[model samples]
Target: MDLHVSRDFLRGGRSLLPRQWFEPMLLAVTAGALTAGGLSWLIGAHDVADLCWILGTVIAVVPSAIWVLSALRHGHAGVDLIAILALGGTLAVREYLAGALIAVMLASGRTLEAAAQRRASHDIRALLEHAPRSARLRKGDRIREVPLSEVAIGDSVVVGPGEIIPVDGRVTGPPALLDESVLTGESQQVERAEGERVRSGVVNAGGAFEVQATATEKDSTYAEIVRLARHVSAGSAPVVRLADRYAAWFLPLSVATAGLAWAASGSAVRAVAVLVVATPCPLLLAAPVAIVSGLSRASRYGVVISGGGALESLGHVRTLLLDKTDTLTCGRPRVLDVIAAPGQEPAEILRLAASLDQLSPHVLARALVDAAHARGLDLSMPSNVTKEPGLGVAGTVANQHLTVGRHNHGSPSPAWACAADNRAMLDSAAVVWLTVDGHLAGAVLLRDPLRKDAPRTLRRLRSAGIRRLVMLTGDREEPAREIATVLGIDDVHSNLTPADKVAAVHNESAGAVTVMVGDGVNDAPALAAADVGVAMGARGSTASSEAADIVLTTDRVDRLADAVTIAVRSRRIAAQSALSGMFMSLAAMAAALLGLLPPAPGALLQEASTS
Candidate 1:
């Protein structure tokens, strides 16, 4: 589990050791030197104290000098140049105590930044540990345990109860109850029937079942998620330093001011005082502290931000693009309404239909059965059952003939159920017609309803400064528009392919920072294309999670707003801290120039003002 630190610390090639080790090592050496120097000064061993302080100053200046030279080579002038000058200048003037203090402070700030990066990388690497390593390969009646890497497409894998599914495949036998909370964040156990697709990372919660694999281990869903997670950890970049922008001008200004002070006073000690006070400690430390704090806060709410750059961008998102299914809606179809014909009871119609559907494995059939059970309706077992795929199911329930499904050819025209059909169309629902004794009786309308908290989440997003909300979905225009109207979204782009979604994001991003939220394989490309891609990772496709810049670990969509709120607050606090710290440093520098402060006192005052 090697976690690489950001390139900023590693770019100079000055340190051969791993970047993670650099900060702690520097801190240890500086602390030892500081402690030894203070003890010698207390014992009146002034020469020994000066020697200790010189070691600390030299230790700190070497690496910072390397960093400054590296930046110069790249044509980048960073604020770190100020700290190097302060350390060297103080030592050159024989202000041993001041040089020692500056060295310790510089090392302390670097350690804090390094710790934050390690925490984030640790969080992402956990995904890799939980991935399955092997699968039960079934050849005819015999099953053998084999490494997951050896499994290939079309192989039959036997999954035991309570075991994790190893690859993407379809159920081959009786229905299997699976717990997909690790993938989707939903705690419910879903039953996948024969021929129904099941993804990796799901647990078999019920009886053991067999699956005919459709993808190899390398190409499986969970594998892709692991690959993405690894990439995030290895490629983690340093947050753009808000302080570095000030460094471009501040560095030269500090150097010139120090030169003038020395020329006027005819004392190098006076010049050292100016440089000591001008060090930009706040700019180097405050920005990373604030951003890392924001990342930690977001993680507590089940939102994982990639790095500092993503967090900063999230704080400023002006337009949000949403995917329709599994993002705004539950992605699971449920019975919403049941309309019965004249002289018929809606409950009785549903009871009869559910009774026949109990033996079927269709997704809609399960929805009807669940709905009936929710209403506390007792259903009798159907006899002489017959099924017509994509059409309907017919059987005898309570001695009365019943048929439940879509209307079929040569069936009596549903003249009396025209209102039910119209209602289904308007609501963008799937209608399952119920017929009894050859007469159309009632229709049960099912649709993927909005998540319980979706409306509230949208309201929060609006309050969080999202100026525009647009929905991009592959669903038909009618259904998409219907959902948009319900959600109060002003823009709707329907029937979009993966490429189309990317184009839509690019177009919106031209004017404002756009956030794209999605939860399926088709959403992967668009997720990568957006300014900030948020994946509904709990119970969603792992591909989207892999491509996303931010992932909601829980199933709640409202966390997105929570993350944005944290980002904005963190960035604001960072700006305030950096600007105010610099202001105080400027005032101290003025005092140094006027000779009211010497090098040792100036360094102490600089630290006090920034603190």
Candidate 2:
């Protein structure tokens, strides 16, 4: 088949060269060869047995030879080279039975390899199939179904319950409960209020909501993931280097040994024996099997590693640089403490701030409302509430003029600057000033708490051979140090822009393999600059996930430790299997050179060593 035909089959058509086809054909040929050999030994029909064996060998070797030629044309020095040489040498020596047996072994090895590759790559295909193809576009007042390609930016789309979002957009209706489990491996339903951005592929779990499309389907988050998966899969995995380098060394060694045996013994049979024993089957099979097994294990833990190269790099990461916001903290700020005016109660100030913030769409506003509800405080909607995006909210609460926002730049009012405790809280926490009738009333301190598992996760990472753990963030020094000290991370770089973060990762990578963990659009460049970039997928920006080599499907940063452990274990297992196989093959080759092995027996020994 042509390359295009093969690709089409792999994508979504009938298999062009499926294992089923090769497996059954090889089995039938093997059975025929065995029957012919047994009948000839019983009735003395040697010519008939030779003919059946030769025919079976041709049947099995032709397809493999074509595949080898195709691979050579594509500039790939595949492992099939060794199998081709072994089969050709047996035929030249007139060892028909040995040729047939070697053919069966080659076919069985290839079938197993194909099965393992399919198992390892199941997630990529599943991701491709899960993307939505059609969208419900809102034209005027009526909604109509249209193919994703026809949906344009600025078109309004209606996402109903149980349907996947077709494009990136902003919620225009009431708060919608969305199941973003497909994009981020978290199973929780996220509530998206008006003006909040929603990505494609999330399932709308609540009632229908109208979304103003911000990006076309092709540029959506789900489509980018598909493109990234395809690009990564097309590149060769790291273990291919082990197999290629091994073949480069073993091929010439095997040929030279066989040639020397022939010249020494003046017997062609001895040379054929050497070739049979040094087939390199183990090098072809063991490394791939181990890698695929590791990938399967990682999938079970909700980490989608693109390839063996990425996994291998993750295992060797020595310096880990983390973005503080969503990577370490929860990325959501909560009301921690409230300092009211001398005569006013803290509860009264919080009540008024929460009540005014109810009309605001800022993330901190939601935290305030939730905190107020948890404290059993009753809140009422404030009249004349006004919200300025970057500034804060203002309204009339209990017939008193009130404002909640940053303090005026010129000078801090005596109510805040006079208290040492208030200054300390302002230094470490996000402080929002409250004013009543143009006088400073109080301040609300908000803190983005570190993730529950951040400390334990850092400890485990250090144990996994990470020499240096650094925090790189745009936050101020005090808050950054607060998180680093709690996590026992010694290195902290604060007030870093996205460019500074990239430079930090690049510089750290010069000393050792560095890993960058982040989850925001601003973190994309730094993520790409590291040796391996790990994206916290749950609640992470699409840009970050697209740039990251390894994506943790869940929000749990602790899974990074688990991923490192899996990668190390996989690499160790693959190395062990490959090295052990090579040693066994070399020992068998020594026996063959000493005239202790014949063609038939040598083939059996090679197969056993590989197994």
Candidate 3:
């Protein structure tokens, strides 16, 4: 739990304001009245004891009556009706201490509900915080910084190194090295030549360059994603609590039965007995207790369920929609394996390739360097290093010439290198070719590896009653399908924008409870749109985490299965407690109708059963 939430829980599960402190204050007053009344009766002041008990009961009844009336005015009736009737009926019969006990139980229930509902508002600001606020506008030979709104379509914008692209545009002068991972979920830098289109929100990974804007800032891709997120969040329906749903029907049944008891016996006392016995304490108390237990258990397993409502819904999830990038894969490129040609060694090829790649700033270059370091290989410094913009890097290392990059398409590659390329394509991995002394030596294959526990997690979800598994991603068809195939996913939607992901979620959620799990800014809208959004929050973007109903706080994907298990078990326990309590209440109500039980003793019996 967050430190602020922990403080709120300790303070009667609500704010410290007087208005919000009603339930806890009422509980304290009720306890004081019970203690004072007992002492007064023991000292032969029976009248004084009755007054104390009456005062406590009235103080508690007034607010509960008002709340009941307010709920009725909203066209809803809840279990609070039973508590109000029990308090009033006990007071009418002068059973003061019994009324005081009812007040204590009612106040306790309200406090628990208030505490369980303590949560911060959904954070929409995370989506807009990263938006480009300013752009470098190039006006006919003079470049100046301006608000993003001032850069109109057809204007020239200068994107500096490490700066985010501010608008959708086409590169103008030279090839630009851009990282488009935010847009496409591809972990490699792309070289965009003159006349090639580029989307907004990508970072310039190389030297500064100019682009001809084809869209204004508001009309760009990032802005559209922000707009979609806002739309989905606004349109999402509020969760109806499980206790409230049961209260809707249970309230009417108890009221009608009590009315019948009064008519049949022609005595107000009989009706009071019926009302006392029918107070739904189990729904009020046991349900919230079970949900809180589930939330705590989930936290122990590295999942943070937002509230009782989300926890209850998790028990009923059937279809799970997954995002491809960080949800199922490692989200970064890594060296998978190396292929060596005749008379060449794999270790020697990787060492030369990594050594030559040390000075490059590309994402794939870093992957090679990390791979070499992982193997504890000592690298030689390259003297005379040079890059061929869109091709590869070349240098001299320890008296040998080395070149590392993609094989030139215009030139013939060795048969062995060609064979390696074919294998890399089938595996959806990138191939980096290394040439030593003017001959092709080897190839290094790189890929975003699937999470080690992903397979086991899927099986556990099936055991926990997930009926369908689908994947949605901004990645291309080949890579997305490959992952889905490996994981045995039933459906795959590839190359999706934020809007497309939201549409997919809506489609999946039409007649079933759907869970969308993701870990990127691009998933924020869909996270808000799904029936239950689960964010991989340990390394996920803040936007997606804020929009989700449940968050896995650890990097372990298997903990999600544990969350579902806890939800299902908690709900079962709550239902069992409620049903058994209701059965006992029915028997007590029958006894009261026959005049075998009275109001005060019946209230005690009901309280004991629920407790």
Candidate 4:
């Protein structure tokens, strides 16, 4: 077992090395070096200290040398070139103790990096491992446990109340309240009746129901999220050191400075001291440290920034874009209007429509059922039921030939259901047709409810200095325009394909950073194409969330403003920290050149003052 662990460590040390081991080692090395130097000095063992320096220099220089050579051979501009050059030069000049101190600190920094990655990877892994395994399958006269992939469409799967629905299917039982916050971005429990489509991963709240599988396990919603989280996490680039960018020139520049100092001072030691003091640790590490610090702060607020770079860029965004469905609105259709026929009681029409509509699997149908339930109205059992596609519904209720849906504009109206394309009128109303004894009764209009915070969030962003707000949607023009008017969006582009949405994000976007927000399959591409994509209802779509730079765990658009606010704060903090480090480093560099301090004291000032 020990051998296996050692082999694993050797094989995957760069990616898999755990922090508990290395972090302690760094502390031990740092403590040991400081103690050893003090003990040698107390014994007045200058030769011993010199000998210790010799051994440490050779030991440290070998690895740093090898790392530099390998980095160049592989055509890599090493991430820590400035630190490496400064440390290597210090050791070569017999300043072994300074080299040891810097080395231990750099090692600790690596441990910090490893710890941060572990936290993020752990979150992703936890989500993947906790996904449900088996689904309840109903067979002839008995329910059986079966592999999820083996279940086919139209096969009844019994999902117990409070269990995660294993796959997408049409409900074949009584009305159920489903918590689809993870599937959609809303906090409310959704109502679903028989024949209504129920997405996988939604928890059945109170009533257990039989759902005919419409999609398999591999094609399920959770699976898609797992896929997206993995895809969107492509490695992010942390800010590279400015010193490294100048290292080629800085090296030549440092060499010239040292030569000029020595020629003016007539001492090579002062020249070496100049090289030792120009390490650039503060310039290289301060921004990354500040970024990580900001990320840490964000995590406390329940926000997960993918990395430092995302936090940096998100801080500077000037434009905000939103998708209408699920992002700005509740995304659930609810019964809104009841246009009853002459002398037809509104209560009677709704009760009748809700009963039969409960047996149909449609978005609008579920809303109608919920509205009736809210009014304490009950529907009678439907008889001679015949649900014609797109014509709405027709059946014998209380021995009356009742029909529900749009008016038939042509042909014979099923002598019952039947729409001839004329039923599609009233484009604004979410309407459902009703028929009584083959007679057209009336239509019930249904519309999606608006989110309470959307208006305030939109208004606040403009006050928050957002230069423009654009709304892009895959939905039709009329509803989109209506939504735009309600939200007070500055720009609206409706009826766009996923490709079109991506293209639209590209248009009028050049230098200014744009943030796109959405929560659905259609919004995935646009999310990826934007400067920063914010996914709403992230618990629902792993792909969209993963594709987005930011993921909101709760299905609320208010988090959009919160995320922007947090990012801006983080970026401001990073800039301040970085510039402060630069100012200090520059002052120390100036002092070293003026012979104000020797090499050892200069390195100490750099590390101690910066920390």
Candidate 1: residue 390 lDDT (0-100): 35
Per-residue CA lDDT of candidate 2, range 1-611, in tens? Answer: 01100111232555555644655556666657756775785688888888877777777677667666765676556556666766787889898877777776766665666567777777767777888999998878788999999987668999988889998777887998999777666778899988667888789999999888866886676776665567544122656666656666776788888899899998787888887777765444766777776776675566777777888788678889998877789867877788887888888888888888765534456567667766879987688987642356788988988887655646655744457245644658766778887788887777888889898899899888899999998666888898898888869998677788898988888889999998766678899999899887655656778899987766688888988888878778767777776677778778888899887787777666656
Colliding residue pairs in candidate 1: 183-539, 184-538, 184-539
**Given candidate 3, what's the lDDT at residue 408?**
61
TM per model?
0.73, 0.74, 0.62, 0.70
State the lDDT of candidate 4 residue by residue for 239-317, as single tens digits: 4332234444555666677788779888766666676666554444544545555655554444455655666667778
lDDT of 1 at 300: 61
| Candidate 1 wrongly placed segments (more than 4 Å) | 1-16, 72-75, 153-165, 168-199, 202-215, 233-238, 296-304, 333-447, 497-500, 520-525, 538-547, 606-611
Error of 3 at 261 (Å): 1.4
List per-candidate RMSD values in Å: 9.4, 8.0, 13.8, 8.7
Best by TM-score: 2
Give candidate 2's error at residue 595 in angstroms: 1.3
Evaluate model 2: give its lDDT.
0.74
Query: In model 1, where is the ten-residue run with the lowest total lDDT?
Result: 1-10
lDDT of 3: 0.74
- Model 3 clashing residue pairs (backbone): none
Clashing pairs in 4: 182-540, 195-361, 196-361, 225-542, 401-437, 403-435, 404-433, 405-433, 430-445, 430-446
Better of 3 and 4 by lDDT: 3
Over 1-611, each residue of candidate 1 has an lDDT whose tens digit, in order, gives: 00112233444556467787887989899989989999999999999999999999899887777666766665566767778878877877789889988888777767766786666455555556768999999888899999999998679999999999999877988999999766554678899988677878788999999998866886666776666555453122233446656665677878888898989999888888888888766444666667777876676676767777788888889999999877888866788898888899989988999999875644467678778877889989788988663356899998889898866537455666777767777889767888899888888988988888889899999998999999998665777888889889979998677888999999999999989999876788899999999987654565688889888866688888899899888778767776776777778788888999888888777656546
